[model samples]
Target: MGKKCNAPPECVPDYSKDEAYLKTVIPTRIALFESIKGQQLPHRQSISGNPIKYSSFTIPLNYSGMIILRNGSVKDGKKWISTPLDIAKGISKDWGENALISKVNGVLWDMLRPLEGDCEPKLFKFDSDEGRDTFWHSSAHILGQALEIEYGCKLCIGPCTTRGEGFYYDAFYGDLGLNEDHFKQIASGAAKAVGEKQPFDRIEVTRGQALEMFSENKFKIEIINELPDDKTITVYRCGPLVDLCRGPHIPNTSFVKAFACLKASSAYWRGNRERESLQRVYGISYPDQKSLKDYIARLEEAKKYDHRELGKTQELFFFHPLSPGSCVFLPHGARIYNKLVEFIRNQYWKRGYQEIEKQEFGLKPMNCPGHCLIFDHRVRSYRELPLRLADFGVLHRNEASGALSGLTRVRRFQQDDAHIFCREAQIKDEVKNALEFISSTYEIFGFTFDLKLSMRPDKYLGDLETWEKAEADLTEALNEFKKPWEINEGDGAFHGPKIDISVSDALNRKFQCGTLQLDFQLPSRFNLAYSAEDEAKKERPVMIHRAILGSVERMLAILLEHYKGKWPFWLSPRQAIVCPVSEKSEPYALQVKDQIHEAGFYVDVDTSDRKIQKKIREAQLAQYNYILVVGEKETEAGTVSVRVRDTRDLRDESIEGLLKFFRDEVAAFR
Candidate 1:
């Protein structure tokens, strides 16, 4: 039996009536002076004849502490004097030469932006995540400064994004058209700025002042007009260049040791097609020369894997102006696509997932709706708690032409999509299983991926309580797996929390390939439920939406780039090409090819009347994995001379042995 509740005073013992109880209930607070008795305050020094005052409050000396200025003055108890330059210097000194100084609060400001009124501050070291973003953002500004000096382009906007290699900026060049030819000049300019060690000077100006300063630039003027009159605009000045920007730039431009402009394309102002077009330059910047060299090497490696180039070389796929976004997969490309679908389908079959086919049109951009319909088709019981469904369905979205590139962005693609319907208690295990599957699949492709947990968005479908529960479930699953994941705040799907897997290819380029989402809203939206063990009651089962490979076309492109068209044995479109030494051995080569074809190898025989060297050269250019050479000596022994791609080494092996070897390699890929 529970005791009855009482009022606050009644619940507490009366000191006069119960003195012993009073002693146990109350605890005295420690005196502030005694609590910090053995501590020491940070030392302060004058800068440029300005006597900067620091906190007198005793703080732990062993562990560094920062004096944050919350209020305007040092006299205010809330205000703590700390200069930005001091913080940057402290970090750089403590973290060593590789340490980067990142600005906070829209000021990659000079390490010297004095702590003003009360504000929250954080110190960044070399490895801190915030520090890296700040470092990259500051690099963008340095690039902007260089552009201004070299080309005198009116800067519109430059921001760091998680695409390409590093950062990019959209600048409007009045009457001066910029293209790829200017990349070298821009890179040279940026390198010059990096050498200057220009400190990013941050200043807060009134809206009127901002308008006056950027009056000559229409884009900036338009941006300023949209801001409120009371708003304060921040500007970052480097060398002779000044631009209205809100940034936490690096301590100085010297930290940006290497930079390069990759390409230039047209972008609409503010990403709106209706707005004026601006020339956008894409570039990547690194901290050191080694990183820059590695990036260039990777770029060269990536060129080999370029899907468009591979398509042309292999005669696998083609794009036409008639149907811009739609791709025409040639016979070879179609075969690979079919093979991938079959592979994923086999996995689904072994996992007890019901393969479902649904209408392509009228389907939402997502695959969840079709899965919902399948879930509704049957009255599930608690005994069948986790029902898995998989699909390899074609999906289309309205993507602007400007947004499409290579295989990264496309309108039509197939998704290796699946949905798991499970009881609330089974959410953790189901999510873990999905993650394991995604990990294993990526590992097989020689990819390293990172996980990210995305939370609810600004506009969400469910109540706070539901969202909290959903988020908790996801967090619990992530914890159970013990995987390192970064959080993407307010960027989840409309209905739930999701885990996004970003995988890095051979070029060290990260692409979003896998996703696992916990959705309670979707089941309820579709009125889906399963019967309980009690026989009468029915409860809505939670839906876990997932996709191991987001799109077939995109993944193919990534693979093409990752391997540089030198696909592994099984994935190679042309696995082996047979070249005869002369017309004398042509008949034998054809016989060998037929035998290999019967064994399921993609074998081609060079029957053209050309020199044996020319044939080998052609096969090499085609990137065939194996080149088999046959001549009078090889026919007498009933063996062929095999040459592996990308190498000159030749080995003699019997026809049967060669067939066995190639089969084993292909099996390993599977």
Candidate 2:
């Protein structure tokens, strides 16, 4: 019954149509079988004119598979495999250039180079780390060409940087030195090189050929002579210039669409201080125009927030060449600094932490030794497992003058430091509490921060097992907090694992402000322990070193730049300025100032015989929050005309009412 139904209803085709359907289906089925057979077939074949035989197959990027040769030898392989030009030719017959590009790690490598063996390949885009380095390295060659054309400078070494925007090259500028004035000429020359759109041609040469090519430049010759005998020498050339380099550069010079000269400095050759100094020219380039614009805007904004300039303008701090790396905080600056200390002291007091003073010039470079002295002063019990001690201690380090910057890098600075002596089992909880304190303090300053866990350095002091346990404890603490943090491998202190908090300001510049360090070695070094509940047991207590604000002076500088000299009412040294309209109202203004002073405000009466507008302008320039104008109308009405800074609106309110308003604002700190 089913066969009959197909013949009439399901199979509606006539005899002729049935034959056509069969013909189409049979050929497709046969073709599928043939294609599958071809894929399984061995590819050992010789081209018409090629001297070597080759094998070929389709492979995906980064694929892991096995290749079985005709000789019964089996080899594990990835998408990338080491082969000579003959094998690549055979593979090229089946696949296109895209496969080759993926095989060589997305690099524009030479097609004839032999692939010797199988390995894992990494595909790269323009934004990948390796890709960016390759692009910038090519750009450095272009820069060398431009410099040669413009200044006739002898290039020594140019390399891409890991931390900064782009690359820098060291060169000798003959007798004339390169400075800011030469940037325009160098940029113009670079633009010409970009316009030429020349390819970066790579050439391999022997030792004799390299020696003859760079004989005129002694620096290049010296570097070449030191190379190992088995190493291959290569040179990259763009336009009319060539240099000795080991390169994986971009295809051509036209990729350098945007460029700029950042700075010029003097640096010793190979970073050796005893060697002769060469002129180092720094530059940055981008493939897109918008990236270049964004970089320039950030640089300009940084100039506005340059702490050195703001410190001088606000009369907050100063540095002298005699002291080099040390800063001298003025009286006004000291007022802000001491107030911050008081505020933190109050915080510690509320948190049940004991405040203690430490010696400024101690035997060690850190406060750990002094804290040990206090910890050992008296016998402690197991009940005091997490004893917190606070200090505002000054520290100094021997820093070179060349490494000094504004407030970010200084020799002498004070740290709002604390140490927690706790049992080994309480390490995670103590670290979590410390992090919470740091986050809350940063929130008060309206800053967003990131955490970094720094591991032990090469020159560490503790045993491997102890360091492992300390690292594990820190990892547990971070895991409990459940916050994302970056790892700075091999960058911690000698004796511990540490966490650094880098806070970002309004302009998106980061400043290092807080740190939490775990120290097991220091307690052992100082021989610190507490008696356990079991009368016979005494165990070493772990030490936690933490700081909310690394340095008061540095924090002040950052705040000044962050707020642009406009401090909040509570933090401002001078909260309000009372300016009398004329000499007649001076007495009333003085009385009003006294009233505000009595209300617990910092107020000053401007007794200068200048015009009222000049006095208001001066008050605004000083960044005072409020300017109280006392004239005949104000005195008669028992009101003061209040002119708020950075605004044009004026409010007429009674003296008592105005004082109350400031008190409320100061309390809120808005």
Candidate 3:
């Protein structure tokens, strides 16, 4: 990072005696923002700190027209003069009061930002993603004000997390150390900003103006220097602090009725360890106190089910500083991982998929290119039209260091990845069948799911007609699958349109783990072709990239948390444990364990000195699916007493009977 700006005299607080330099002792800035913003000169160079440069950039506000709301209601508006908030008020008083953000023509437009043209409007309240993100984002700016006023920190960047909640800001605090003890002052300052009900005023500024205004802060200067010459440099002011942002912020600061400082940590500037270190402070905000309280409760509840903690206790996985974003699976973790792969393999078998393998170790980001070569290896007739290929080979990509999280975001991972090469006529059937496969699999894991058909992005790989056809196929497939799905406009891969699946776990948290992406670009680029039914012309097959368990490592994490370590019988590493009631029955317990293991199930014999009850209790705590107890009567009868995990049900069963039961559960995919 550039050298951090020291606490300049203007930055020095008016209320603190510790201020070695105060506003009264400092030279005045060139001009107040309000006084200079109205200057429309094409190239104004007369400025104090830096030579000023102004652009004649202006938004046209002359077009008067009608805006069509999503519900078909029409509102008269003037382009660049009217905003989503104005149209929202035309709809209803409640909408005007509660709308945190609005979608103008399916784009996330700020409620306060002027409409560019006549468009359809959809207002979002705090319950929606757009609204919540804006809410948290606005709160981050308030936090920025707090840090600026109280600590004189030079703010770097503040953004909502990619995770489901909250926001954080990275700032340069120079030599001032920060910790939880500093949270009180931060909170007090944030509260002061909130109480002021400052409007989030936004204005387009000249590059020279931006430089002169942020002349004291090199961090902001570095960002300003990188923008394209014609790009609009917008600034937002809330209370005393002004920031450069691409904002769709809430109308004002008072929207954050509840706020809390989460934590403080050290981070390298822009996530590059070679750069200067900065302080990152995280916080969460809500429009009401109750929501914040519930979020805190969930945080506490989530700790009990955190996958990393469970991984430690269950001996599942471990990470080392030497290998960031890569996990080493212990024997137990390997069992769980392999079990998931095996489960998907079983589905692949039932789904008519041919397993394919490729080299890994960061050589490729996905198995797509290799599979494309497989399909293009030779000319074939239309008879083998829908060729399906499956792979569990590891894949690697260069994920940013800051973006890596536990297993959810990893640099190295494997997926139950597959590709289907089929005819265009078969698109709906293939997609519907894929949906069925996903439904059955998620049902097994007890996950409820949501579907969205993402359309072609603005910058796409193929012709518009191809994209339209692909989107239509996905839309028809989603409709035929009879699931409620929404359109994610312009959210598709550049290669093609896709169906994105999000599964909700026990905590009602959603994870994007399944997808069916239709790709036309790869097949065309690979020049793959098959003989048509007429046996004269060659036809290119459409490639459908399918993934149920998107990433094996991520799925492991989700299942670990979703199941709360109570792995189902089929997936459990500790499927069964044979406990000997006494030393005399040790041999019997070993025999029983051997039998169960021979039946193709994971089984262990507990020969420890602990009493049978304690052994059973420990096994249950370890999340063993089954506990088998052996004693004199059971030994004589050649039977074992069995108890299911987390249950009071127990029964005595013959060795043959237990093996049969194991086979049944495996067959049923229990």
Write the residue-wise lDDT of candidate 2 on 1-670 in tens digits. 0111223333433322235523443344334434433553333122122322224332333222223223222223322223322333334443322222223432234323333344333323344434466667777777777776666555799888644358888876544567889889889988998999876655566787777666656678778999989888877667766778877566567778898888888876666666645788888898779988997898898788687887787687898988876788886676677777877887798776888855555623577788888999888898987999888777788765666788877888878889999998888888998888888778777788877788888678878887787788888887787766755667799878899888888876677778999888888988998999985899899899988887877898788878877878777776889999999999899999999989877789999999999999999988888999999999888889999988989999888798778878755655
Best by lDDT: 3
Which residue ranges in model 2 land beyond 4 Å of their true spot? 1-176, 184-257, 268-275, 361-364, 456-469, 479-483, 653-660, 663-669
lDDT of 1: 0.73
Native-vs-model 3 lDDT? Answer: 0.82
RMSD of each: 17.2, 20.3, 7.5
Residue 2 in model 2: shift from native, Å? Answer: 99
Each candidate's lDDT (Cα)?
0.73, 0.72, 0.82
For model 1, the run of ten residues with the poorest summed lDDT: 25-34
Worst 10 residues of 3 by lDDT: 53-62
* Runs off by more than 4 Å, candidate 3: 1-96, 113-118, 175-177, 205-233, 268-270, 320-326, 358-362, 380-382, 398-405, 533-540
Which candidate would rank higher by TM-score, 1 or 2? 1
User: Across residues 556-577, which tens digit of lDDT does each residue of candidate 1 receive?
Assistant: 8888878777778787778899
User: Which pairs clash inside model 3?
Assistant: none
